[model samples]
Target chain A: MRDVAIVAFAQSNCQRDAGAQNEVELIMPVLTEVFKQTGIKSAQDVDFTCSGSCDYQQGAAFAFVAGVDALGAVPPIKESHVEMDAAWALYEAWLKIQMGSAESALLYGFGKSSPGELPIVLSQQLDPYYLAPLWVDTIAFAAMQARTMLDSGEITEADMAEVVARSRNNALKNPHAQLKGDQTVADLLKEATYVSPLRRHDCCPISDGACAMIICTIEKAEEWGKPYAIIKGIDHRIETHHIGSRDLSRSVSTEIAGKAAGVANGPVDVAELYAPFSHQEIILKKALGLGDDTVINPSGGVLAGNVMMASGLSRIGEVAMRIIRGEAKRGVAHATSGPCLQQNLITVLEAK
Target chain B: MAQLAAVVGVGQTKYKTKRKDVSIAGMVREAAVNALEDAGLTWNDIDAVIIGKAPDMFEGVIMPELYLTDALGCNGKPMLRVHTAGSVGGSTAIVAATYVQSGVFKRILTVSFEKQSESNAMWALSNPQPFSPHLNAGAGGYFAPIIREYMRRSNAPYDAGIKVAVKDRLHGAKNPLAHLQLPEITMKEVEDSPMLWEPLRFLEACPSSDGACAMVIANEELAAKSPRKPAWIRGAAMRSEPTMYAGREQVNPRAGIDCAKDVYAQAGIHNPRKDLDCAEVYVPFSWYEPMWLENLGFADEGKGWELTMSGATSLTEGGDIPWNPSGGVLCSNPIGASGMIRFAEAAQQVRGEAGDHQVDGAKTALGHAYGGGAQFYSMWVVSSEKA
Candidate 1:
């Protein structure tokens, strides 16, 4: 396979509501930032462009079509879109490069989650015949998983509280985080339960945001003279969609994808995981076999600020940025979709 | 160099106004199972699954792939969902091909579907945005002006669209799975149909359909061992421009032109009309047939209508280069699946499996689909023999 690297990454600050700012407006700033970092004029410079987003975020069909307006795609460009997280968009772009179809690619993901009842909107992702008709929201599903873990002695409420405490403290250094603060584990544990055994702080905030990344062949990275992180391996796996079919406390797909992505090939210095619920971070850590040496969620992860379609890509961006800045030598980034992480992707990045 | 890929199996659910007998998962499974049966493989033999659809709102399901994992047998495997508007079907097929072409997976199952009976597509497409004008009601309302511009620039005969409608419907009659089997449809009948949009009559527009299309793509190694002949993928390309921009050519969009040029060049076709044996271009409206013919290099600008008038694009009429021999979007438009149906039909022609709609001795064919105000385009060329 041709050597590929993430050369630049940029994202908008997570907001409770990006009022009146449409998808194009939410995306343009990040696009400009990535271009500035790469010293490129527009998407015209890239061999391919792809994006990931959902129409339900805007309450309309084909909502992603508006995002092209931000790219200045006037001369016509090779492009595609996925109704998925941008991390998968990166995967598609990587495949294009692997097939010798493109030398470089520009990819982005965006979402306005504050417009709708985020959890209810996400419930539609469940099995239509069995679960979606009941409108079992996302938080309710996560709570059930948390309950399962607690009852099985896999984790304690204090452990979940500690994850939330650390996430909040870590987000203090992340300017783009939507939820951040210096809070003690005891303080978090004191919060009233929003759902049985789960507090409001345990769930990620609904935020509107966009993120962009530029990837290219290692040769192009050197030619551009930008500090970059090589993508060593990337793979994704999906589990059965039936919520009752699998163990709710463990992420089987994550383990499969992590193994496939070669996460254990090297020592992980930093790990950024898309764990919308605080307990999921613990679940992913165990699945990936990360040790105490790994600095997990240095950017507070999605628990601090989840941007829906963009958050998955952000996990990857966080790890790549750490490597580019010489703060970490190797890292693992993970993204998830579906209730209780039915689908999971693992990307391993290393510094040059 | 990229690995070679081929379509070893193709399957599609019967196009219809509503598939009342099956649920969404059952409907999609039918196509996937048919494809697997054609490939002489089971669900476990596939390496990955990639699905595509126009929008989540169309079925009131957000990212339906999450729920479809079991139906497609994607458990413990990589699955990707693509959504590129109307071109999603063709784009999804290309993505599946890339998995094999990139040497990432040996065999991939790709599916595209739309169950329009579950929700109102017209309403889903016509949602009012905050700043965008709500003047256009549905797709027809939006494309009527573009069609009018094409008519004025080409100065084509008014009967040109009527001729295409009758021709494609007649072709549809030969395909048992097609939604509209208008065996006796005539130009005179089309002319008398009610006009929904100017220059577009009821019969000239595509019907709303519920359907799914699927294909099993494999590497050259696996394809060679297949029980049936394979359609070798010659080339694939996609292009996109902003939906609207200053001085954009809506009648003959640059995206479609560039996409065709790139794919033809990859397929080593210097002249599309002479090289490609047949084509299955997306023509949701009849007038788009001639407009795309010119854009796709089948004919010179302003002369595509002459080819239509000469019956050069008709299969039953013994045309040298037939278009949509298995009917087309105008006969069975399941929105998202429409594009892949075009692509699969093209492959069928090359594989000599198109049954009654077969273009005689077709060795090479082209499949094309466009979406999002004609700004997004996906096209591929397939040949019976490997290059």
Candidate 2:
């Protein structure tokens, strides 16, 4: 594969309510910032542009078409869209570069989950015939997974609380984080469960925001004169849609994707895992087999602010930023979709 | 150098106003299974799966590919969903081919579909946005003005669109899978149709359809093993421009022009009219047939109508070039799947498997799709010969 690198990254502040702002407004600032950071004058400066977003987030067909208005695509730019997290969008961009179709690409993702009841909205993502009619929200699925782990003696409620505790502590350093505090595991465990074993704090916030990143062939990054992180490997895998067919406590897809991504080839100095729920982080970490030396979610991960489609790409950006800032040398970023992590993407980034 | 990719198999579910017998998942699997069977491969042969559809609202299912994991044999495999307006079907196919072209996956399953039966497409498409104008113009209302502008600019004959509607329906008569099969359609019949959007009669506008298209794309090595003749992808390109920007020509979008130019450049074609055997251009509206002929450089500006009038785009043996031999989007449009049908039809023509609608001895063909207020465009050139 060609040497693809992340040259720049920018994001909007995670907010509970964007307050009358539409998707285009949520996306424009970050797109403008990434272009400015890369020193590229406009959207035309990039060889390609791709975005990741969900139409269901706004309850409209072809809703993502509006997001393109922010790109100022007057002269027409090579572009595509993914109904997925921006992390997958990044993967598509990487593929374009590897195929020699493009040298530089700008990718972004956005979502506004506050307008509707998020869990109810997410219920629509389930299988229309079997699960959606039940209104089986995302949290309910996570709760089932957590309960399975608890019943199987695989993890404790306190363990899930610790994940939240650490996330809160780490999010304190992230300016864009929506929820951050210095809470301890003991305090979190004391809180009542909102759904059986899963507590209110165990869930990621319903944030409305967008994120943008610019990547290029290493040669193009050099010409752009910017610090960058090499994307050493990336892969994604999905599990069966039938929940009954999957092992709820284990992330088989993440493990397969992680191994394919070469997550074990080198020491991971930092990692950003997109586990929207607390217990899924434990599931992902064990699947990835990360060591204690790796700093997990220094940018607080999605629990600080779950920007829906943007959260996964944000995880990748967080790891890339740490590597670029000399805070780490190598890292693995992860993103998940569907109920109970039916699909997962793993990306490895390293300082050149 | 990028690895060459080829389409070893192509399949489509019957294009109809609604396939009420099957569920959405069942309908998609029909196409995928047909494609795999055509490739003479099983589910285990595919390395990855990529699916595309316009929007979740159309089916009332967000990211329906997730629900279709098992249906497409994507479990424990890499899967991605693409959405790029009406161009999504073409873009999805391109993404699947890229995986093969990048040497990441040797064989991939790509599918695109729309189940208009699940909901009202026009109502779903007309949903109001927060900041956008509330003109309440659905897709046809939005495009009619653009079609009018094309006529004004080119000073084309008023009968040009009616001719397209009749011609494509006649082609549809040859394909059993097509939604509209008016074997004896005539100019009078089309002209007698009600004018829904001024110059565009109801017959001139594409019918809403429920269908799916699937293709199996493989690298050269894997394609060589296939029993079927492969349609080698010579070049693929996609372009997008902002909506409502000043200087943006809605009629002849620059994105469409640039996309065609890029793909043609890669394919080493200087004259689309001469080099391409036929084209499966996306023409949800009849006028788009001529409009895109100019935009794709098949004819000079203002002369696309002349090409149509001269019968250059007829499917019969007398025509120099053919367009939409598979009846195309105007005859059977399932929105998301319409673009892939165009791509798949082109591949089929080059592979000499287009049956009755086949352009005789077709060696090279073009597949094109555009979307979103004419701002998004995707095109590909495929040939019987290797890239």
Candidate 3:
């Protein structure tokens, strides 16, 4: 495969409502930042542009078309979109580069999760005939998974609370984080349950946000004279949709994707995990076989502030930023979609 | 470096106003199974799955591919979902082809569909947003002004739209799977149709359809092992521009023109009219037949209607350069699937498997789709011979 690198990244601050600011307003700032960082102007600078977003996030048909306003795609520019997280958009852009279709690409993801009932809105992603009609919230689905692990002696409520505590503590250093507080596991465990066996603190905060990034060939990285992170490997895998068909406590798909992404090829100095629920962080850590050596979620991860479509790409961006800042030499990023993490994507990034 | 890719299999469900016999998953599976069978492969042999649909409101299933991965055999495999407005179908195919063209996967399954009957598409489409109030004008109402402007600029006869309506419906009649089979349609019948949008008769607009289309794309080595002939992919391109900008041309969008130019350039075509044996352009409205003709370089600016006046686009008289021989969107428009149908039909013609809708001796063809008020454009060129 052709060598591709992450040259620039930017994101909006996580907000509860972002009132009056539509999708375009939420996106333009990040786009402007990435453009400035890369010393490029508009979509014309890149050979391709791809976005990751969902219509359900906005509750309108063809809602994603409105996002094009942020790009000012005049005189027309090559572009595509995925009804997925921006990490998948990066995957597509990576393939475009490898295929020699283009030398550079701009990728973005955005969502306003505050507009609707976040968990209930996600119920529509379930099997329509079997599960969605019943209106089971996604939080309940994750709760069941957490309970499964709890009953199996895999983890305790304190362990889950500790993960949340670590995430919030890590957010102290992350200025973009929406929720950040220094708290002990005992303090987190004192909170009441929002869903059975799961405290409200264990779940990610619903926030409105958008993120943008630009990637280019390795040669372009040097020509631009900017620090970059090489994407050493990336892969994604999915499990059966039937929630009852597999054990919710284990992430077979994440393990398979982790293997495919070649995460073990080198020492992982830092890892950005997209575990919206506290328990999922432990599950992914086990699935990827990461020991205490890998420092997880230096940016507090999505658990501190979840931006839906943007969070996955944020994981990638967060890790790449660490590499660019000379904080870590190598890292891993993960993104998930569907109830209880039915779909998972893993990417391995390395500093030059 | 990019590797070669080819379309070795194509499949579709019968175009209908409503597919009540099966659920959404079943509907997509029908097309997938048929495609796999056509390619002489099974679900286990596929390496990845890429699906596309216009919007979740059409079926009320947000990211339907999540629920669909099982039926597609995507377990422990990469599954990507694409959404690019109405052009998503074509864009999805482009993304799927890249998995192979990039030498990442040997075989991939790509599918696009729209179950418009599951929910009210018109209401879903006009859902008011924070910045814009509900106009309540459906797609036709939105495009009527553009159609009128095209007529004024080109000086097209009042009967130009009527002729295209009758011509495509007749082509639809030849295909058994078409939703509206009007083999004996006439100009008088079209003229009497209700005028929903001024100068646009009810018959001139495409019908809402419930259908799905699927294709199996493979790398050079896997495609060479296929039982049937493969449609060699020459070029694929996509373009987008901002909507409602000042001094922008809505009738003949720059995005469409640029997209066509990019694809034609990759295919080594200096003149589209002669290089392409046929075309399956997206024409939801009859007037687009002429508008796109000029935009796609098939005709000169302001002179595209002459080709229509001379019956040059008709399969019977157009000889080698027929457009929408399979009746097209007007005959069966499952919105999202419509674009892939155009793409699959292009592949079918080159593979000599289009049945009755086949353009005689078609060796090269173009598949085109545009979406989001004509700001998003995706097109591809395919030939019987390798690029």
Candidate 4:
């Protein structure tokens, strides 16, 4: 396999609501920043382009088609789309690079989460024949998982508050974070509950954002002389559609994808997880078997800015940037889709 | 280099206006079972499943693959869903092939389908939303101006569009699975038909269809062990651009040209008109037959209409490059499955299984599909001989 590396990455700031901009407007800045970093003049220089976006988010079908204009596709360029997280777009670009079909690939993902009621919109992802008809919102779904953990004596309400405290403090350092403050666990415990035992701090705010990344072979990475983040391994898996069919306390998909991605082989120095809700981060850390010494979500994570589709790839871009700047040697990035992480993808990246 | 991929088995449901006789799951299963049977394998032999479609609104099922996991026999394996407008069928197959080419999976199952009968396609296509102009006009309304431009640039006769409608309809008569099979269609009948859009008569447009198409792709080891003949994928390519921009040319789209060039180069075909035996292109409208002939390099610009008028696209005629021998989208169009049918028909011709619509001694076949205001394109070349 040819050695593929992440050469460039950029993203628009996560906002609670960017009413003036649509998806296309939100993506223009990200595309410009990525190109400016590489010094490439034309879209033709990029051999392959791929994007990740959802029709539901934009409230329109084929919404991503307008994104092509940001790349200035005048003579037309080789491209593809995935109705998935932008991270998968990066994965497809990586495979194209590995095949030697394209020397360089550009990947982008965007979402406008503020357009609709997220909890209501997310319910549509459930088993439409059964669960969706009930109209059980996403918070209520997460509440069930939290209740299961509480009943099993695995965690307490105070433990959840501590998680909120730590995440909010971490977000204070991130300029793009939508939620950031300095508060203690005691302070969070006194907050009113939004979904019984799950306070407002436990849930991430609805955010609008976009992200872009560039991938190239190791030879090309050196030719360009940019700090490189090598994708060591990647895998994804899905569970039964019915939330009740599987154990809510555990994520079988994460375990499967993690094992396939060789999560146990070497020491993981850092972890960036796509956990929109607080308890999900706890569940993911346990599933990944991270040690206490391993740092997690130093960039405030999704708890600070959950931009739906783009948030997942932004986690990857953030970790790659850390390695590109000589901050970390090895890291793991995780992305999830569906209610309560029914589907999961794991990628291991290394700086060599 | 990676192990080359080949289509060991191919399957498709009967093209029709509506397959209400079966549910969406049943429609996909029909094609999947046929492909597995053709390969002499079972669901257990498959490693993963990749499925795609134009939009979830077509069936009122958002991410329907989740509901279809059990029906597709992909519960315990990895299943991926790709959506890239109408070209998704071809892109879905290419993604599955990549798994084998990347040495990840040995045998992969790829399928794409559309149950247009479930919902009104015209309404679903024109759903109004925020921050976008309402496309109240249907596909014909969107494509009329481009057709007018093609006529002006080519300086073709007014009867040229009618000739295409007559030719493909006559060709549809030979295929049993076609949706619109008129045994005796005439140029006068087409010309006199109600005009839905200027430069395009009602008969010149493809019918709304309900159908599915599937294939089983495998690596070298499993491909060599297949019971039936295999159509080696000589080349495959996909390209896309913005739907509209300040200076974008809608008449002769560059996306089509770039995609064709990429695939032709990979297939080592310097002169498509002379090297290719036949082509199954996406012609939802009759005029697209000639437009694509020029875009795909099968004929020179401003002369594609001449090729269609000279009876060169007929299977029985001694034409340089016979086009749409299996009736094509003009006769049968299940929006999502239409693209895969082009792919399956190409494989069928190279495998020598196309009974009545077979092009004599067809060795090289082109499968093409485009969508979204002609901004997206997917093309592939299959050969009887391995590259």
Worst 10-residue lDDT window for candidate 3 chain A reads: A55-64
CA lDDT scores, all candidates in order: 0.93, 0.91, 0.91, 0.84
Q: Which residue pairs clash within candidate 1?
A: none
Spell out the clash pairs found in candidate 3. none
Clash totals in order:
0, 0, 0, 0
Per-residue accuracy of model 1 over B122-153 as CA lDDT, tens digit each:
88888886668775478998999899999999
Task: Order candidates by TM-score, high to low.
Answer: 1, 3, 2, 4
Candidate 4 chain B — worst ten consecutive residues by lDDT sum? Answer: B313-322
Superposed model 2: Cα runs more than 4 Å off: none
* Highest-scoring model, DockQ: 1
TM-score of 2: 0.99
TM per prediction:
0.99, 0.99, 0.99, 0.96
Worst-scoring 10-residue span by lDDT in model 2 chain B = B129-138
For candidate 4, the TM-score is 0.96
lDDT of 1 at A156: 98
Evaluate model 4 with DockQ and give the value: 0.51
Candidate 2: tens digits of C-alpha lDDT, residues B162-256: 98898889888889999998998889988999999878999999999999999999999989998989999999999988778767677888888
| Worst window of 10 by summed lDDT in candidate 1 chain B | B128-137
- The alpha-carbon deviation from the true structure for residue B354 of candidate 2, after best TM-score superposition, in angstroms, is 0.4
